[model samples]
Target: MRALTVKGVRIDDTFAEAFGMRATAVIITADSPRWAHQAALTMTGFATSVIGCGCEAGIDSELTAAQTPDRRPGVRVLLFAVSTAELQKQLQARVAQCVLTSPGSACYAGLDGEERLRLGNALRYFGDGWQISKRFGGKHYWRIPVMDGEFVCEATTGLTKEAVGGGNLLIMGRTAQTTLAAAEAAAAAIAKVPNVIMPFPGGIVRSGSKVGSKYKGVPASTNHAFCPTLRGAADTALDPDAACVLEIVIDGLTSQAVAAAMGAGIAALVKLGPRRGAVRISAGNYGGKLGPHQYHLRDLTP
Candidate 1:
């Protein structure tokens, strides 16, 4: 196979395998942008992977006062789960614990679809029979009294079963610093794309994992093949000069959105080139057995 180079970075002829997921999006508003972001960060915290976290979530975008339903500063968060039942459970728990607890916070549907997930509907119980149900703009909302004032949340949010998860990029560099820089650039680029979220901390994952572990009962373990320190001792996938590898995993409402985000990230890496960024770019997959969606690196290269 011919080598595929974009700018000075070598693009591996591989694809990112992604599985289908049940996803939902919610808009959280607060008295200020700081509070809104605080709630979002808290809600999305510890939610990096479904294998352990029960869900994968991240802030999709920040919203201005003019963009929110309540005319306040807010953020849009997207969450993905393996099944609708799990998604519903996670969504209700996060919103009830994080958003409702945030001062002056309000939650609304950020997405619209025939299928729906419980939001305020489940949290209304906390109101202790004091929660007020209101119908506004053909949508149902529950106003739950709190210390600051009241937490207003929509009865339900849209759920999309067509969501895609596990889209990723492997950035390998000669040093950890350069590899981190490349991963940051890719993360920033991907953040700008709508309908997608990078659930990892800072949108970069240092501990990339394979399907299973050497120990029994562990569903996943460190990807030793990509570890620079384990080069000769393991079935290494990196070159001799490669010292570090970082991955960016993405989940999107649609396959197109995931592809768009991956393309944007690749373009950002290409702009930085090999000298300041990644020496090589690849993707993780389980030989196409993991999922139905396969985003080819060559096809995504800009």
Candidate 2:
């Protein structure tokens, strides 16, 4: 395979091994885009990874009024979990707590998959006998009265079993600030890619973790090799000139989408020029033991 390189920055030829996840797309709509985003951000909060948060989710994209079921501004958010049961639990809790409470917000099934999970069917109880069910083109929605008005939510949400998660790229730079800038630019570029989401703070992870931890109770710990201060002490991955590193993690509806997102992020970072301080692009994996999907950096490069 050809080695990956752009603007003199070395791109590791290894793959970012990812695994299949149970994912569902949620459509949250409100009176305006601002309110739609408010619900989206809240629902996806603290969901950077399944290892810590029990789920992973992010805003997939925004939808125009014409594209939404209620003809309102909306956002598409994806939630991924290790199993369908866990995913269903998360969907119920998040939508009820976040979207159902957001001003003028409504929720609907974003995907048309056959496997469904209850949403409004369970939340309607909050109305205490006043909730009404409406059928729109065969889909059921419940209107539960709230303080402001009624909160409308669909009866169920769809699921995809083979969704891929944990695709990532590492940016090594001469300074922490430079590494972060490159990561931010890469995230902006990745955001434009369809069907994928970078589920970390500002789409970047400063504390990337490895699969195992030194402590028995913890399943993961900070990736010591990537730590600039641990260069000599911890069998580091950095070069002599490297001073800091940041990682961009991506989760997508399909393997193809993940690869496309990775390519877009790398291309965006390359535009910053090699002299901008980012000297290398790498990936994280567990020697092919972690997941079945392998996104190769070499294959993503031109």
Candidate 3:
């Protein structure tokens, strides 16, 4: 396929294929911002991919005291899963293990919808018959005893079925250094957009994968087509000059949020241009068979 040039950068005539997912959000508040962020970081750990981790989660944004239900500093966390059952399980487990154990931490609903997932309702059993239930300001909450003091959590949190996952951008460049810089810039820009999470280490992935592997029972394998070292031995998709590649995968509460994130990331790459940023910008897809949502590169390009 021919590549379209924008400010000396090549934009592939491709699209990112994404699929439907179930998502939920929760707020973890504490006496101070430090502990709140610590709990959020711990809860989101080892949750970069649904294939391995059963969920994809990240700290969506930080919240001020005025923005939280308990009037304390907090962090809003978002989790995505392939199904509602998996999302509900992850939410309960993470909150029980991470947030409840944190000092002075409190959990609350961060979203509102008809579908609800049990939060404190599932965890009140941990209190060993000492849990206290109360209704205040038209919301139900549970107070469970703990060493620090008590863990306050909402009865339930709203769930949204409109989440989109696997929206990606592939950055190919002449060197790893330039490619990494461009990826970082795109991540920073995407972080400013609300309701989306990158869900990868440092918001960048070096080991992008294809749908299947040659070995039996292996669900996925490395994307050898874009590997710089396999240029001669394999069917390559890279330009002759591209020496390194990086990918950014996104999950959002809504389809519009994902598209906005993609547009922001592409604009950041365009601002750096080809010399300092990516030589080519493409996307991963399975010939429109992977998912229903297709984010075209041309439409996202600035």
Candidate 4:
């Protein structure tokens, strides 16, 4: 495996190495893309890792005005969990707590034929248990009358084995501004692709985490290798020339999804990165043993 080097940092050729987990996709629509993304951003906030967030989620794709039921712009988001039971619990909390709370936002099951169900029924109780049920296209929907208006969402959703989290990457850049621009560029490339998500703010995170922790109370701690503050320490591992690092995280539920995401993310960043060799990209993993899937940055670009 090879990595693109910039500012003395390495863009590791190794993949994210994710595993199969149960997944669900949600469709959120609103009066405008602004509102739609508002719902999406809020719903997906703090959902960086499944270990702490219960589920990992991101904006899967954007829907054109013609494709939505409300004839408005929207975003499709996918969430995955390690266990079926955990996924069920997440469905209710994310929908009720995030999607439902966003004003003028309505959620639908992007995965329409889910044999198993969770949210629609449980959240209907939020309508004071007076919610009205509607059926369209042989699919059950719940109309939860709210103070603002009606909240229409799908009842049952499809559940299936998905790659879950098999794709991801980390991009490091010299300046915060440049890093953001490059990360956004990468997100723009991946945004239109199906079955993938950029996920975090600007589709990037400055602080990534490690599997174990030095503190007994904290199950995880910030990734020190990528940390700029600890760069000068003799015991540190970061390359001497590394200035700053920005991380871009990708989510894909399929091998194709993983490939496409890695491809777009790398290609876009390469085109937009700082010209003074100030940017570099890499992947994080405990080793090949840590994750079932592997993504090579070189292969993605090639």
Candidate 5:
């Protein structure tokens, strides 16, 4: 599949073939951004991918104070990987290491369904089998009594099959300020749609990673093709006049949902690109290395 470019847009002829993934989202609430950061950072730390971290997780989005359970600042984090069994193990470990250790931190399932599930319940047992389960507004929740109060979390994750992991688009501009502005605008637009979420801060990643690095003990490295500073890496795509580029990584239950976010996101970006030095917008792919899903920018053109 190929993405389109018009005017200030620069589409790439590539496809993001994502494989089926078993994923989970946990909602963490804290008294303030400080506390929220405390919980969120701890929860998502060391969880860059399932290959090493046993789960690929990131903050899906930031929830405004009013949107949180206790009217506090919080964030929704998405964790995904290859299987439901692995999902359980990874989540169990993550919860034990991150959320369990953070004071005033509470976790809730962002994904739940009629399908059979595990994580939340199995891990709750760590409460020395004294955990209390609560069902509020048709959603089941667990209140694990902690010294700091109670660690509130959703009882189960919404598990699905054939999930898509990477739906990314790059925004190029003349300056970092402009690039950031455009990326932010696009992120806001995509956030309005359901069944999808941007997994990075403000929906932008300044440093893009490639498959491997030459450095010792580095399995993955930065994507030099997209970096303006790495121009001599052979067939790099950097626009010499380009001052900055930002990436947006998206995830969804299905390919269509991801595509929808991409389309809407690109539309919102088109409106800000020119003024903010955003000369082009493009997508990233592994040269058809991913499995079956493809989103074309031409189809998403506004």
Candidate 6:
């Protein structure tokens, strides 16, 4: 494949290492679009990485009234875990805590019927025997009586094969302000891509971490190599003009989706112009000792 570069920003030849993760797609709906988004943001909060959070999740997209099960505006979110059992626990907890509790909000299976997890079935007991089960369009739904009338939720959601997670991009620039801006632009562009989500806050990670840490109990720690403040004290990879670096980490439904997001992010940064201070685009890896999927940056754009 031809190498990819834009506005003097060189795309690294190395690949982003990712691992297999079980994913569950869920739809959250509320009485108003505002509440729908509120529930989505709440459900996906603190789920940027599986290392510490135990799962990774983000809003896939918003759905129109005609596109939702209840003919209401909604949002689709994808939750990924290391295993099906763990995913089931996370889904049940998120729906119960975030969606079910949101005023006038309800949860439903976003994936088409296939391999399944009994999410609602486990949560039905919250009704304390008052919960009612209904069959709609050949699917089971539970109506849990709550303070605000009822909270409707699907009994099961499909669980697909463990897909790639932890695809990332390192954004380096001449200053903290410019680097943050470039990272934000790249993140905004990636959010528009289908079947993917930037799990981190604003889709940018200022404290990007490595797999292990020097402290015995810590699994991962800040990547000092890319820290501009630690340039003289640590082994740095930053260019001479680079004053700051921010990383965008992506977790997608498929490897292709991840690559597309990375490519789109690079394109967005390219549009910001070379003077925007985005100097180099690189990726995170463990010398190929990590996951199976290796997303090469050059091939993503070329």
Name the best candidate (by TM-score).
1
Q: How much does candidate 3 score in TM-score?
A: 0.98
List, residue by residue over 1-302, the lDDT tens digit for candidate 4: 55565344356656576677778888899988988988987888877778778988888877878887668788888887788888888878888888898889888777755366576877888878779999877877889998889988878677767655746667666666666677777777888778876656767777888766877888778888788788766355455555677766777767788788778777776666455333677777778886777776767763
Q: What is the per-residue lDDT of model 5 for residues 35-69, given as tens digits with 9 covering 90 to 100?
A: 77677777777765556677667666788888776
| Estimated TM-score for each candidate | 0.99, 0.97, 0.98, 0.86, 0.78, 0.95
Please provide, for model 1 over 85-104, each residue's C-alpha lDDT reduced to its tens digit, 9 standing for 90 to 100: 99999998899889899888
- Candidate 3 clashing pairs? none
Score residue 165 of candidate 3 by CA lDDT: 96
**Candidate 4 ranges beyond 4 A from true positions:** 1-11, 232-237, 273-278
Q: Note each model's CA RMSD in angstroms.
A: 0.8, 1.4, 0.9, 2.9, 3.9, 1.8
Candidate 4 displacement at residue 165 in angstroms: 1.2
Candidate 2 C-alpha lDDT tens digits along 1-302: 23467778888788898899989998999999999999999999999999778789999999999999989999999999999989988889999899999999999998888888888988999999999999979899999999999999999888898799999999988888788888888999999998899989989999998767879988888899999898889887788878989999999988889999999988888888566747788888888986999888888875
Off by over 4 Å in 6: 1-4
Per-candidate Cα lDDT values, in order, are 0.95, 0.89, 0.94, 0.75, 0.74, 0.86
- Cα error, residue 257 of model 4, in Å, equals 0.8
lDDT of 2 at 62: 98
Query: Candidate 2: which stretches are off by over 4 Å?
Result: 1-3
Give me the candidate number with maximum lDDT. 1
Greater lDDT among 4 and 5 belongs to 4
Deviation from native of the Cα of residue 166 in model 3, angstroms: 0.7
Q: Give candidate 4's whole-model lDDT.
A: 0.75
Worst 10 residues of 3 by lDDT: 1-10
- Ranking of candidates on lDDT, top first: 1, 3, 2, 6, 4, 5
Q: Model 2: how far is 29 from its true place, Å? A: 0.9
